[model samples]
Target: MRAIVLGGSFAGLLAARVLHDFADEVTILEPDNEQEHRTRSGAPHRDQLHALLAMGHDQLERFLPGLTEELVDAGAHLGHGEQVQFYIDGKRRPTVPGIRMIGASRALIEAHVRRRVLALPRVQVLPHRATGVRTHAGRVYAITSVTPGGDCHELPADFAVDAMGRSSRLGRWLEAAGWPAPRIERLRIELGYATARFHRGHELPDTVVAHSTPGPASNYLPSVCEPGALTAVEGARWDVVLAGYTGYRPTSDPAAFVNRMRRCVAPIQQVADLCAMEAEPTTFHVRDSRRRHFRELPRLPGGLAVLGDALASVNPVYGQGLTLATLQASALHRHLRCGASPHLPATGYFRRAGAVVDAAWQLSTTADLAQPHVTGPYPFGYPLVRWAADRVTQASILDAEINAAFSDVLHMRQHPRVLTRPRVLLRTARTLATHKITRPT
Candidate 1:
């Protein structure tokens, strides 16, 4: 069997890696020719702080053994998810431990993953731009693209997968081919971000922090690297990201970015007077959170499928994209494992992937909509979710089991529904009844 993967970034690389197991030859079609694995110009967020959720971290290890160790060997920082200080609505939560995650620049993670995927003998990364899909009797057969020479050609494949990011144009091509465009759920989030690195050399900041505004104000997230973290691979001593939601956005100007980071920067730098900035700040923004409902489509060609952000993109602030993409790739692997025939419908794959996406979509969007400034339809159980989340926040500090459960959900290691178990709910309620909440002034 032959397979072609479009857009050779993280998702594309993962897709090609998974397909390599089932196909005789798997080709990755990408336009970017940058040889190094670090972030390319197409992915601007590479310079910002990034975390591989425990679930994705585990998946990557399953897909590529020794890959995580290779990253640390190459100077990437190894750490646990619980080491970071977490806050909800500007209120601090317990620092639970044991969830495994790695700390590194997003570019570094991509670069390492890219290297491993390209190493597979059956996998090839080609410099090509996929313009459209051509189908035979309603089944996808070939992809048309323009080579580096500017000459257009059609590449035949038994299966074509799209791993293009959020800006993918797959829907348009499908619509042009007489298939109705898939339904989309879009939430106007108006999220803004600015990031920079800082280090005092004498003191290495060791915790990540996010200070989300309590009421109408926007969300603010700032991070500091772990002490003794390997920085040679990422080329930065520390990584900091300042993020906000709604209309509140951090300025890109150095001084303005510093001001936005004030009171919300890393703990060691909270004094501001002590820590020194290392470089000018860069900015990235997201106008909305979007999810393409491909599973709802009445009919989809058998040979084509969408993965990662093309299927669903939520607020990056939640840091679920990479993890969710890995889950989707795993689902694709299972689907292909059942059958390698080109005529096999992708419905089973979409169904499995959608189940995974549903959990992430609900958790992240519910949190994003917690603030009133972001305009969007309330998901079911809105009030109950808020109440439980609040109680969990306060309860996690005092109750270790609750803390462990909440940490599991946050890391995507367990289903969000686990928090709703009778025992956990009872514990949260009891903790809330006895605990008195107070905020430091």
Candidate 2:
């Protein structure tokens, strides 16, 4: 069997890795040169700080064994337990057992993953732009591609994947080929963030990761502390990022960026005061969170599947993109391993991947709705849900057990519904009540 994967970034690389197990030859279509570990021009946010949550870390290890040790040996930090800090409203949440985060830049992570994937003998990369999919009788049989000089060509495949990312042309390609495109749902966020790297050495010795965001005490505004995060990434460098919505969006000014960090959580502030800026701030803006509901389509071309940002692109602040892609790749692997035919539509894969997308969407979009400027196609009963969710967030800061439950959902290891469990809800209510009764006021 032959499989073709479009867009060879994180998601495309993972998809190719999975396809190698079932397909005799798997070709990755990516325009960017992968000869070095530097960020690609196509991915402007590659230099930005990125998170590999506990589940993403586990899946990555599962896909590329010994990668963790490799990363650690190469200087990437693995923050476990207390070293991985999360703060709400300027106060750190209670440390929870089993929590973990990998401190690495997106470039380093993608570079390593790409290297591992390309090392597979069955996989090869084609440096060309994928123009469209060619289908016959409701099944994709070939991919139309073009060269930099405008030469067009076709590659036959038994299976194909669209990992083209947020601005994927797959929907348009499918529509042009007379197929129904997945309906899209979007929530405009107008979020902007900037990341700057600084030389790191012996600073925050016990801390590898720190993230701070507005919460209940500040009414989800940056009144108490500006929302920011930082990690001890490779090359003995600290990668710090500050985020804001609409008018409060971070800027590229190096001094202002550090000043913003000074107002964030202590770890970020410490970095701002202690470390020398390695370079100017790199910025990226997010217009909205988008998801393509493939499962909602009545029919799709066989021998085809979509993954990664091509499926869902949520708020990056939540750090769910990479994990969501890994999970979707796992879903694709399960679908093929179960004897599901590549000659037919990947209904089962879409269904499984949809569940993952839904979970991430619920977690991110719900939080995004908290922003005052973000008008919502609000979820049913959002007011009540928001109240309950805020209480859970507050309680998570106070109770370790509740934090663990909340962390699981935040890290995408478990569904958000886990927070609604009777035990969790009861604990949250009791914790809030106790804290209320013991207030200094």
Candidate 3:
């Protein structure tokens, strides 16, 4: 059997790596020629900060042994949970031991994974622009692409995987091929982001700071790196977004950016002060969080699967996209290991992947909705849910147990259902009561 994976980034590479074990031959279709270092144009934010949560790291370690060691060997910093300080609701949570994460650029993580994937003798990387998929008699037979020489080629394969990023055209290709249109949900938030590398000095603390505003304010997620370098990302809704939603957009000027930094929590402000900018600002435009309901399609063609951002693109602020993709790859491995019929409909995989997407989507979209400017279909009981979340955030500030519980869910190590437990509810109630009792009268 032959398997052809589309896109060579994180998801596509992981899919190709796993497919090699099941298929007789595996090939990856990527447009870029260079693989030694991180390349932009294809993935513009390759040099930006990327966090690998415990869940993602654990999954990668299990799927690809010695992967973490490889990253550490490549100069990636391994930081424990206590070393990283989290500030939420204008209060800093006391850090605890045991929970840990890897801090590095998206390029570094991809480089490590790419090196391993390319090492497989059975796998091949083809540099070409994928045009479309050709299906015949209820099965996908080949992937058509245009080579650099201007020649069109049809690479026949037993199966094909789409790991293309946010701008994937698989939906259009499916529609052009006579497949029913898949349902798409797009929340156009019109957010803008500017990121720059900075050199950290001795005055800066070694930590990661994430500060999210309620609405119309900029949020920052900063990471301190080796050689006293740091990466800072400043994001806000755009002018068009300000006009459409609320008047809240971040400025591109350095001085204004510094002033806005003061609005965030203390730790982030401290980092913002100690670092000297090292690179030109790279800005990004965002359309709201999007998800395509491919699982609901009446008929999905056999021998084809879609993974990664091609499947669902979450708000990058949540840092859950890569982790969810890793989980989906793990799910694919399980399905193949059980000798499941690959030719059957992909509803099962879609449903499973949807679950992963839903968790992250809910967490991110809920936060987006909190911003006064963000407008969308209010999930049922939006007000109540937000109120409850706010209460939980308040409780987390005072209670260490609550902080740990919230952190676990935020890290994707535990499900959101844990937040609804009776014990957590009781703790939240007690914290609220205690706060009220101590209020000035």
Query: Local distance difference test, per candidate?
Result: 0.73, 0.90, 0.69
Q: What tens-digit string does per-residue lDDT give for candidate 3 at 158-228? A: 88889988788988998888887578787666666655555544543455434333321122112111011
**What is the lDDT, from 0 to 100, of the residue 269 in candidate 2?**
88
By the TM-score metric, which is better: model 2 or model 3?
Answer: 2
- Count of clashes, each model: 1, 0, 1
lDDT of 2 at 183: 92
Worst 10 residues of 3 by lDDT: 235-244
After aligning candidate 2 to the native by TM-score, how far in Å is the CA of 302 from where it should be?
Answer: 0.4
lDDT of 1 by residue, 1-441 (tens): 789998988889899988999889999999986746444676766666666777899999889899888888776766654446555434455666776567666777787888999999999988998898887676888888989899998999888899988888888988877777788888888877776666535354454333233321122222222111112124445566666654556767877666655555245235234456776667788888888888888888878778988888887766788999899999999999987565555888889889888999888877777655765688777878866765665677677789889878877888889988999989988986787754211
The alpha-carbon RMSD values of the candidates against the true structure, listed in the order shown, are: 3.9, 1.7, 5.5
Regions of candidate 1 where Cα sits further than 4 Å from its true position: 35-39, 89-92, 200-202, 205-233, 265-273, 438-441
Question: In model 1, which range of ten residues has the least summed lDDT?
Answer: 224-233
| Top candidate (lDDT) | 2
**lDDT ranking, high to low:** 2, 1, 3
lDDT of 2 by residue, 1-441 (tens): 999999999999999999999999999988877547456776777778898888898899999999888888878898888899999989899887788788888887887898899999999998889999999987999999997778899999899999989999998999999999989999999999899999998889988999888886777789889999899999999989999999889999998898888898898988999999997898899999999999989989999999999999999999999999999999999999999999999999999999999999988888889888999999998887788888899899899999989999988899999998999999999998888622211
